[model samples]
Target: MIVKTSRPAARLAALVLPLAALAGMGTAAQADDWTPTSAIEFIAPANPGGGWDTLVRTTSRVIQEEGLADQNFAAINVPGGGGAVAWAQIARDTGNPHKLFATSPPIILVPLAGTSQYDHTNFTPIARLITDYSIVLVPRDSEYQDLNDLFDAIRENASLSVGGGSAPGSMDHISIAGVASAAGLEAADVNYIAFSGGGEAMTNLMGGHVEAVITGAGEAAGQLGPDSEVRALGVSAPERLGGPLADIPTYQEQGIDYTFDIWRGVMGTPDMPEEAVAYYEELFAQMLETDGWADARDQLGWIDAYQNSEEFGAFLDEQKEEFSEVLSELGLIR
Candidate 1:
């Protein structure tokens, strides 16, 4: 290697070396980028027409219309154990990024009630999308004009059962419990019947199996009209919502000190890669900004409450603490 190269030849060689280095960098960038290679299984941990099912279907439709992701989103229903069945299934698929399930307070409430083996800690929080209110419903022919009237009857007649779409001590159970307790009835004494979904609860109410039902307001939309069979006794909202729900009274307006929000979000399997979480976080953020989501929110009566994955995780922690205190006071957190 004694021969010395000319200055021009040396410069050309140096330029070629830099070009090869740039190509290698490009390859690494491509390798780092992650996206779903197949259709995604968007699980709705509940029966069809339930809140979770509606959320998944609506979200997938809007995302598709907006061209948010290349892969298709298929909504799968797995109803049981107040979301325990879906939680167990997702838990089994550890580290899977393709699987995502719609979540509400049940994600925390179910496990707190000893119905689920896993809690929010067992999954990857993707994004908190919206907040829906809980509504107290009664037969249009029922004499219960308000929360007080309903709770009074429940107190007078111990056999009266207030049914809900969640398991006992879960979302719907705790909702009516909080209000009934506030109305001078023992929270533990409030008779709450469990149904598989809101639709089934509504059916039983018509069949006279239960006196009343509480579910996400969005889930009761179709049953809240002049021609419908159900009447809204009160809603768990600080103020009355707009649109078809505007006429419905709030617990506060009726002189009860109670409010509950059904926070809906999405979660992935345990140990999902940070890359997948990041991708979904961004995708949802963008989806919320689109006109399609706005329209759907208004129609569904969902309030805008978007939180990214990290923020959502922290929010869940706060919710766990607050709910622990509430459920403990109600004697349900055993």
Candidate 2:
């Protein structure tokens, strides 16, 4: 029972205008007046070792090592409901200046799927920090040499299961469905299996329980090696990435016009004071400029796509609308 509706361009335009205005109104001097006097609670809305956890932990470490924050930062993991649990807790603490959470696409997608009561609109956007692309993977010994080979099989056999870390209508599933729709297949026809995390999904792929996996490029990189038992068929980036991911080809390069990026950011509880929002916006902007942040970015295979609170709010609005279209096409929205 998926939901569907047509969203007018005007609706999105209306959403962005106010956010853009809010972003433009904040001042540096106002931000300085709201510095935290005690340890700041940085919430990672997922378990340790996952993307959300990695983001807050890394950013906190960089902020500390670079002497960017006067107060000690503490990262707390509140894992459940694919971030709904943590988001609910944050909602209950609305207007708290010291609490912030790492967030991403699920903040938009999950709520739209009606699996959560809260959405991006429920939080105060602080900053968008980095972006990570998705990679399609298959077992090393499998016959599929590329994404086309894999898609061909799925097209022929609709039940051929594809695995992902998040739920049915979330990031990894959406990435594959977007490509499938572009490649002339019914997006709903492709069977997608949701695992608790990328590591678990990879385990199922290695065990030959699923034909393919779509996960974050960084997570895929950690599992791939010269002698590893799996291979990356394609990445959901417009262009090939460098370093360890250099050899992998983008879907477009492989003749498919599909691209997706998992952008990670921080958001505070709702009703957060304007000064508090201003403070985090400035803090994250400075953190992005540090050498320590750059090193972590490279190590994690993340690309810098920093946006302050207002810009991030507008981006989230656009993303919500874009995801609505994609999910509707895939029959995941109702």
Choose the strongest candidate by TM-score. Answer: 1
Measured against the true structure, the TM-scores of the candidates, in listed sequence, are: 0.91, 0.86
Residue by residue across 197-241, what tens digits does model 1's lDDT show? Answer: 787888899999999888999878766788998899999999999
| Model 2 spans > 4 angstroms off | 1-31
Give candidate 2's whole-model lDDT.
0.87
Q: State the lDDT of candidate 2 residue by residue for 16-36, as single tens digits.
A: 999888776665445657788
Relative to the true structure, how large is the alpha-carbon lDDT of every model?
0.91, 0.87
Instruction: Give the local distance difference test score of model 1.
Output: 0.91
Q: Candidate 1 has which clashing residue pairs, if any?
A: none
Instruction: Find the 10 residues in a row with the least total lDDT in model 2.
Output: 24-33
